[model samples]
Target: MLREFHVHDRKALLDAATQQGWDPLPAEELDEDDLHDVVGAVMWLADSGAEAEGADGLLDLGKARRLRSDEGHEVAQWSPEPIMEDFGKGWLHRASDQPGDSDQSEERTDFAALFAAEPLHCDDPECEDEGCLWQLTPRTADLLHTALTVLADEAYDDAEELGDKRLLEGEHEGNWGVFARMPKLTFAADLQWRRRFARAADDLADDLEHDRWPQPTCTAEELALHFALDDARDLHDELGYEDDADHTALPE
Candidate 1:
């Protein structure tokens, strides 16, 4: 019959072993007697704080354990990358750099040339008229950066919708069908770029309202609201909202 060891038995066994100056038995060799002895030794060592060098070392070990557990959990919970798989391994590198492909490189070069050749109008009305808002503002840039980041994050889901919508419309479509149907990330980038442009317009409106620029008939607040409404109307029309044609367009 296997004997059960209790707290009193453990304490007594540990005390007897200590008195006899005998080393504790290994875990595999442990019966009721050994378990009692080990538990007593553990409890005594815990109370004395003599199991390790110092309290700081034990605290540090606890912190390390917690950090490692957190990191492991994060790794385990990681979601698969969405758009990266769709675009292929070389797509990002190729899209950004256009390396090795003369045709794509030339296209990028042409776009740069076109952008440079076009009249670079600051979206800020004040900047456009007087060039006062041209100085780079960190606050403005940070706001734009945050907005762009959010837009980029949302673009993957939008891109999926675009792809799925297109696929459903077609009778015969394959995996490549999704790719062919979706608007390019370039298109989403352009949309985000337009929003940044709108933000610049808004900043200019703010400056005007604050009397930073030449006097205007309407208060800056009024003009800003008007432009914002116009933007909303434009977006509504673009998104195919069914409204009277006259109601959606800006007044002449």
Candidate 2:
């Protein structure tokens, strides 16, 4: 039925299914919907430039041509694109292995000093009076932000696994509280950030009506710092830390 329907790129469809850990149905056994889904998946994978070589090598041209001809559809040929460039291809290779200047190392050390000197703070009002806000540091803030980003990305992956119907729930206390207490405010902040980062991308996608970039107003560093403080407050509330761990290391 799939072959008869002339579903474009049937082999590629089967290949994608195999790559996804699913046993590809024999061409003779596939129904229309199955074939349609396979074709759609293949097209999606190809468009995303995913590297998945299933049963056939990349771009199985023979199968593609047959499917397109059978379906009376235009067969678009896949081109081999250069993924990267070698700067020294046409130039002489400098053999001197002298290490580059240590400017970046010095700058990193200075940045670390600045980070260490900054006061840490908790977001909770109660903690503020007791100087509990000083429990979070710049490094911790970076870690917290990275963790949240990873969590969010995982949620997105889960949503995809569930067929894209999942409404992601914020797992972090800071994000959840802000989202629940002031959804509009949170949304506005997100929008503002997106607008800042998206200006350059928006220009590139001028021809596209719906192209958008993630908001990038506030520095990720700042967001991470705030997130860590908020998370630390939530932790304080939940864990009820001893005075030693919670206060001695915390800056006044």
Candidates' lDDT values, in order? Answer: 0.36, 0.38
Tens digit of lDDT per residue, candidate 2, span 62-149? 1011222333544344536534455345434244422442323222112122234343365666765544544334333333333344
TM-score of each: 0.20, 0.26
* lDDT (Cα, tens digit) per residue for candidate 1, span 1-252: 111223335455466546545466676777875563475454344445453211112111110111133234343356675323342342233454332334442221121221122233566565645443343232222222233323333433344344334333235234332222333442333333333333344444434233343123444323333444444444544534354333223221
Error of 2 at 108 (Å): 20
Query: What is candidate 1's CA lDDT for residue 89?
Result: 48
Regions of model 2 farther than 4 Å from truth: 1-25, 36-114, 118-231, 237-239, 242-252
Q: Which candidate comes out best when scored by lDDT?
A: 2
TM-score of 2: 0.26
